[model samples]
Target: MIRALNLEDLGSWLLKANGMTSDIAEVAARREPVRRFCVRPGYRARLMAAGQPVLLWVSGDRRRVTPGIWAAGELTGPALVADGKLRVPLELRWLDDDRRVHRDTVRSDGRLADLEVLRQPQAANPSFVTAEQMAALRAYLPDGCGWTPALSPRG
Candidate 1:
């Protein structure tokens, strides 16, 4: 059964891209207007929704591409089931090679060391990123990338 994601639970997410299956360099070079990322079917995929922030993590050593967060964007729409798979529409806000955050860097940070992607390397596509982790990652992003956490009601 399909369930609605809780708005209060919304936060940053990590979407892994396999370098062997996907040409990271080509995708980064194209700077496509919009892209659809597929996530493994399960609870995690069901939690995804439109307007939530997303980070594209390039996985695998293929093409000599360093594995890490290569891009940041927002989900343009809710998860859609196509061909028996779940896909989320994304619109990238930042995708600069210089701004790429390497896995080593993230591991070195205490706040990001326990990231789901790092903990379970072979985990499914959509990985959860806590608000605190997202804040820590913001430090690595360059100024004017237009990345800002969604304000809370209490704030």
Candidate 2:
């Protein structure tokens, strides 16, 4: 049932994956339970349906952060928002094994270098990525890796 997800419709977004420990990024890349919680309010509707694709960029330790794409996959189910926080159930296809990308290589590209979002990633939450940014990211992906944008249901 999960395999039915259309890759064409999945939207790409950037996430600041730094945590108190390396285990957070490790477990998430392996498609394990990564429960997120927040005690404050100001919740946004992160509408995630079953089979939706998501590109999860994981950053290692704060001391030495890698600058590259990490993992990609479809949402196994809907994202649950309880209390004052959100929990996303993800099914990720691990990208880089060690989970770090070359910062200089990506920055060399004039197109990507201009992107403030990519230049300085927010350490707080996930943000929607533009098509142009996704294109830049795809260019840096490893040879065998594939990232086809999901088609909108409306069209």
Candidate 3:
């Protein structure tokens, strides 16, 4: 069973999906619960660990999909070096259509305006999300949206 996430302790990250090899929208529509995400070698890859919360940001302008936070979940295991990159195991649940946080919404929010994903749109995967930004993002997620707050953001 999935446990409530302690955002404060687990922290949060933004995983970017450009929908090049695999269309993020298609992946989100899948019934699969778990996905193996690979990130290029870097410091951020080294910082990832099990249980940390992550938001899947679907980048790029797809034909019918809006680029934004499409899914949320926690890392299932620490990053593993494989094939010269890091593989992060996670179980993602796609947010409801009405619950998916849009990119424009985040860009408009003053608290989230400076999000790394916004500043470095072309940056590699695994962007950092500040505590303040996470708190702001949480406001868009309603109860039963798959994320259960287990601790205060400042905790």
lDDT, candidate 3, 1-155, per-residue tens: 12222345434767888755566667677745646788766656766776667888887655667778888887777678767777888878788778889889999999987787888878776776766667778889765433443323321
Misplaced by over 4 Å in model 1 are 1-10, 144-155
**lDDT of candidates 1 onward, in order:** 0.73, 0.50, 0.71
Could you tell me the TM-score of candidate 3? 0.80
Which scores higher on lDDT, 1 or 3? Answer: 1
The residue pairs in collision within model 3 are: none
- Tens-place lDDT per residue, model 2, 33-83, is 433322112232244445544565545553655545566655555556665
* lDDT, residue 52, model 3: 68
Q: Write the per-residue lDDT of candidate 1 for residues 1-155, one digit (tens) a residue.
A: 22233335435778888876777657687876547888888766766766678888888773478778888878777779877878988877546777888888999999988777888878777776776678888889766444455523211
Most lDDT-accurate candidate: 1
**RMSD score of candidate 2 (Å):** 7.4
* Model 3 residue-pair collision total: 0
Reference-based lDDT, residue 71, model 2: 61
The lDDT ranking, best first, is 1, 3, 2
TM-score ranking from best to worst? 1, 3, 2
Off by over 4 Å in 3: 1-10, 144-155
